[model samples]
Target: MISQVVIDKVLSKAQETASHSWEYGTVFEALLEYRDPHYSIFHDPFPGGKIPELTVEGVEALRYVKPFIQTNSARLCEGNGSSSDPTSLCIPALLLYNSTTSQAPDNPYLSAVNRQLHDLLSTTPRYSNGAISHRDAYPSLWADFVYMVPPALAYHGVFTSDIGMVKESVRQCQLYCEVLSTSKGYWRHIVNAEGTGSVKSDDGAWCTSNAWAAAGMARVLATLRKSQYGSETADEQKMLLNMTKGILDGAIEADTDASGLLRNYLDNETWFPEVAGTALMAATAFRMALLEPGTFGERYVGWATCKLESVSRYIDEETGVAAPVVNSLKEGQRTPLNGINPEGQAFVVLLYAAWRDRRTVAEDASVPMAGTDASRT
Candidate 1:
């Protein structure tokens, strides 16, 4: 288990980093040193200059990301294009919304953006519809983007107490699963709207995509279980459980590396070293399993805990961050990739929070031993 002090330090550093990216009322795309830092829609200062203002959702994103972007005020507006897609913008907005203390006001613009996102999901063709359908768009192919949207949408639904929103979120999750599931109980790295699969150019399974699917399903399931609407039907519950099981089973089969950490690529051909994204994805799945304890809950919990511990061992304490330390022999044993991503940090925070909450409940005896045992090793 990570000590409180370490957790605090990491949180503090993340928060500090988040602050640096804020400027002119917007958070920059990233804090990579090569990127421009001083830009925001609010204070373009220059007339007809290239950078545009942050969208309303961008403003919303800042509410949560402010801590990390505060110090990097100069870079917020630099790279952002004038016309940003609502889907791409929704993530930071939702994160900001979730982290903030203020209640989401019933503003028309916010409502419109919410409705727009909903429309996008509804109109998008399902994988069952056709391989070249609308769902096979840009974000769908990218695991990171595809996985990020659901939690935000679920949070939006929960916060607004909108049953339709919740259901829509679940449906999108199902769609994602249907499109990604492999014949072998694994998920494909790239999927088409019609449910066809794509192989990585390198002939490897994208570990992060599978991880994202696993984590996304677990989160969606947890959210649905907590909703009053979620309790209305046995069919709903059964479907959710089945989906959860499928994802966990696939993740176990496809992603687990020899080091107990999940690999970023796999093919029964070779084991690649673990990536932080995959580790966090696995951690997210494990955390969700703990959140909703059941028959498969203990298995997910154990898997996540072990994966997190192994991954955490490589974290650079001096930087209060994690970096990839393992590489796949298939890739010729190259050094692992390293970076501190907000998504990764967010998952860590979530994992820590889940662990803390469970510990509290166990100490208080509110959670039955059976449930605890089922949730943890």
Candidate 2:
């Protein structure tokens, strides 16, 4: 488990990076002090905003993002544009709702955003069209992006007591799983409705994508257990268990480094110092091991702890920034992307929070089989 102090430091740095960038309510790819932050709705925005920003960052970020969602939602609703990529519109709405949930009862903005996301997702045919198109788009195939949208949707559904949204969220996740999985139980990095490609590209079997899948499945299962779908339904439980096993198996088979930390790409031997992907995998795997210590239990726990320790060594104590790794391959060589990317930082924060939560439960001996500990793993 990590201490509150450590989590606070990381959040502070991430918030600082976010503040310097475009205040569009979305997360950015990187925040170079010398350059402008690169923002994107598909892959960059952190689902959860940092605390300091929520309290003091004012409504600048939220306000900037508000119009984007409203305009997109109106366009989709009016049938003038495509809602094929629901996440771009859905995620920001979810974030705004989360921001206002604790305060401001009856927040019209949050309510409107939620309604728009629900409406678009419900009416969109591409979700269940059973055809593969838009392969290059992040929402169309990237595993992490697919892994992210559902939780936000499911969370809002539960908060608003909308069973339909909850069901749709599960359906979306199931569809993603079906499209992304290979015969070997490993999910392809690049996915589409037709099939998943086995060839490792320049990116390799991305660690973050797999981690996101693992964490997302775990969250979905937990939510279902609490919902109308309980453990009595063996099929649902089995699906969750199978997804967990698949993720663990993939991580073990894909780890190319002997140092216990996972490689960014399986075929590429380069080491990038960025902590986003690797740290997320470690944290997610560690949480899973604690929750269900069966079969691959020891391996998940041991590898996760080791990887976390290894990553900790690379963090620049003075800057709180995790350095990026540069690939040496001619085709992939480029300056490593750096600064505190919000999406990356969000994973870091969630890991610490989950670790701490688990630790507290463990000390009290009240943790379940899949319990989380907030203390150091």
Where model 2 places Cα greater than 4 Å from the true spot, the runs are 1-6, 19-106, 118-139, 160-164, 192-204, 231-234, 267-274, 294-296, 325-335, 366-377
User: Judged by lDDT against the true structure, how good is candidate 2?
Assistant: 0.49
Q: Looking at candidate 2, what is the lDDT of residue 181?
A: 68
- What local distance difference test score does each model get? 0.46, 0.49
C-alpha displacement of 300 in model 1, angstroms? 3.0
The number of the candidate with the highest TM-score is: 2
Measured by lDDT, the strongest candidate is: 2
lDDT (tens digit, per residue) of candidate 1 on 52-121 = 2343343433444443321122221221311112343443443343433433574223443465455455
In the order shown, the candidates' Cα RMSDs to the true structure are: 10.3, 8.3
Kindly report the root-mean-square deviation of model 2 from the true structure over all alpha carbons.
Answer: 8.3
How many clashes show up per model?
30, 18
